[model samples]
Target: MSTSYDITQDKWERFTFSREGRVLTAAITSDHPVNGVDEQMHTELALVFNCLQRDSESDIIILTAKGRAFCAGGDFDWFEEQINHPERFRAIGWDAKQIVTTLLNMEKPILCRMNGAAAGLGATIALLCDIIIADETAKIGDPHVKVGLVAGDGGALIWPQLIGFAKAKELLMTGDLLTAKEAERIGLINYAVPAAELDAKVAELVAKLQANPKWAVRWTKTTANIPLRALAAQLMDASIGWESVSNYLGDRREAVAAFKEKRAPKLTGE
Candidate 1:
């Protein structure tokens, strides 16, 4: 039917109609890249989510990307813009809300194919997926603390549920990177396979899910995902609020400065 949104930008970002059935596949290219959740990307992603939701023929969605990194998370340029003009912070908050809401509420199963390193919101996106399949060599982290920001939107909602409160705190507080196996071991991801086998593994999983009775699958998925939805509803706002305030604070400023200078950050409560 409406293949219009099926592919807006060829490899930049696209939805490929699967030959097997009603499953829609999305590829996020590493070249044109998403530098975190910015305005244009946010809008386009929302459009993609909406399109996927409306496509009745689509029973499952798979998100994967090109390159050695899945998503680096928020564009520092946008963050720089926000710091320079604190008034625009609310928009970022709204975008964060929308991104989480769209993924959490998707009626069909959403799977993440983590082909490479994913940090910050990138890791968040993977965690939101119904099933996350990562390459054994791939690394994932939530480095908001390293960037002088709080775990806020993504970490605040999902980390505790995935790995328990203590480990989540340790990782989030230190901004530690977890190998794919460690991620799976900690329950952060579903499986960790060889990088070369990632696509095949993901296909096998998606196909299996797709071939199952649609209603039974959907109901099971819907029930299981309710906890995530509830967590987001209760925690995301407060988390984003702290993150917005962090943008105006010294820790984030030092963090960004250190990143730009390629040096260690020196944080001060001020």
Candidate 2:
């Protein structure tokens, strides 16, 4: 690993990056209150992993948020923007696909530090990591259908495999948020510790991952993720396209409007 290798020049606006020893931490530093994914942030999410893989000084990475919450899903304001600029979503769909693929392709393990609430795309990212350790106070779910959008952004692909198809469908369709304990009990995430000890739990696991023979850990992760890789290859493009298409239909609009208006959406099934 060359110390001269650099990720500082990358200039990521929505995130801040730092490395200590072999552990690189990427903190979602968005000021949007809830750290939702916008076009730019979404693009970064797709590309950042590859850059870290090339960073010679890094062996494993921790993905977390700086704000009180992790990503809350797509920005509501951005979702509204898609109503008039629906075509833009096609590009986002492509990026979403890349995010999943690149993460799977990376050799180094990723440990998700779910410090707070995670939903929609956030939940997908956390659940997709090699190890997910969350604060007991946090919650997780893919509530895309509640917002009248398909869980096309890796949600449809990852959830069923992590849990089962039956449980996956029930949560996605119902848009229910699970407490961290509940999620772990259902086998949706790896561990849930009290908020006070989250950092310790994360460090313990990171040490375990880092101390193991690097090649073995990386290869084991890669081979174990093979079935997930195939499913993503088979389902992602079509699922994302279906999700993009849903943005044009009336229900999606209604859902966004209702959330902003703080009222129940009236779905006509149009």
Cα lDDT tens digits, model 1, 1-270, are 455444333333433344346667776653435435565665556556656666656678888776677777767777777777887876767777877888888878888989888889889888888999999988898988887788886787888889999999999999999999999998999999998899899889987986789889988988888888888888889999988888788778878888988998787777
Give the C-alpha lDDT of model 1.
Answer: 0.78
Clashing pairs in 1: 35-75, 36-73, 36-74
**Candidate 2 local lDDT, residue 208:** 92
In candidate 1, which residue ranges exceed 4 Å CA deviation? 1-20, 30-36
Q: Write down the lDDT of every candidate, Cα atoms only.
A: 0.78, 0.88
Provide the TM-score for each candidate, comma-separated: 0.90, 0.97
- Choose the strongest candidate by lDDT: 2
Error of 2 at 204 (Å): 0.4
Q: Name the candidate that leads on TM-score.
A: 2
